[model samples]
Target: MIKITGEHHFAIDRTLFVFALDSEAGKVFNEKNKLVTGIGKVNAAMELTQEIQRNRPELIVNLGSAGSRSFGKGEVVCCTKFIQRDMDVRGLGFEKYETPLSGIPPVLEYGLLKEGLPQGICGTGDSFEMNHAETDYNIVDMEAYPLALIAMKKNIPFLCLKYISDDAGSEAAEDWAVQVHLASEAFNKILF
Candidate 1:
């Protein structure tokens, strides 16, 4: 178990783990951290909500593999901002990535950064990105936005660390399969 003391010297008691796949979760699996994994955005959101309601951990950490056009494979990054890339409502007069009628801002910020890890904005969606989008986001994942949004809504501290598994190219799936263990190992280094 990792113990992180806050500004007030209060140690975080528990941290919830949210991952999109078993391969990613297996790499960082431990008996101490409570883990919940699902395939896509909806499943991840639902599972995370349920987990938070049931466990109510002091912090929520979403760790997993991501495809990045800006970073090299196996590079780990800490995400301080999250945006939903598939939420396009431009025709309805809202911004392309805006969440319609949601009082919360479309962009969610999780402001925790480790000293040596690169910081980035994670773009989340249901589909795996094969072509790069014309956005400023540096990393792409399937579940970070929903996980971050739920953590924000629940008033829980959120942190996301992503390992670049692929470049969002045609080989993304295969690359992710092979590189997930590496990401997990890297995450282990950060946690301990």
Candidate 2:
């Protein structure tokens, strides 16, 4: 397990695994070729961008814990579509979640789907969603959108596996804290 904090780049395997935090990686992922990109979209985008520049990976696999009302806790699901949930440019005549002047679509349909696993639409934003009333996305995450967008632009295959840790409800913070540790194990079972 590698924590990507500084600008230094490390040698990684063909399939690069990415995690939002070290704790989310857990003990089982210690031997795997992984990068801990910290939290939030900017961190994820910067770290992933650097890694790709240093050594282009054959495929990028993002594994992290997410909040969802539609999925049960401890269940690992694939995310094929990503949304920048915080990008609201409605006042500028652009639609909500649409990046102004950027050609990228509001809903990014990029990510390799895993067979037998159910798929989800991830809404990536800076804030931890709690009691959010949005009905568009089934999953709420902090970093998956940028990772998916970057991979899509680079034409590299991307696979997002999110372990449902919370329900994006009033008790999301508490639930996530307790359930995040189990996400790594669930992902290990699915991918490793």
Question: Listing every candidate in turn, what is its Cα RMSD in Å to the true structure after a full C-alpha superposition?
Answer: 2.2, 6.1
Instruction: Residues 1-192, candidate 1: write the lDDT tens digits.
Output: 453323412133577766777678664465546565677898998888878777888778788999998899989898989889888888998877789888656677864665578888999989888776546588999889988887878888777889999988888888877898787678878776
Model 2 misplaced regions, further than 4 Å: 1-12
Q: Please count the clashing residue pairs in each candidate, in the order shown.
A: 0, 0
Worst 10 residues of 1 by lDDT: 3-12
lDDT per residue for candidate 2 within 84-119, as digits (tens), equals 999999998998889999998889899777776899
Which one is best on lDDT? 2
- How many clashing residue pairs are found in candidate 1? 0
Best prediction by TM-score: 2
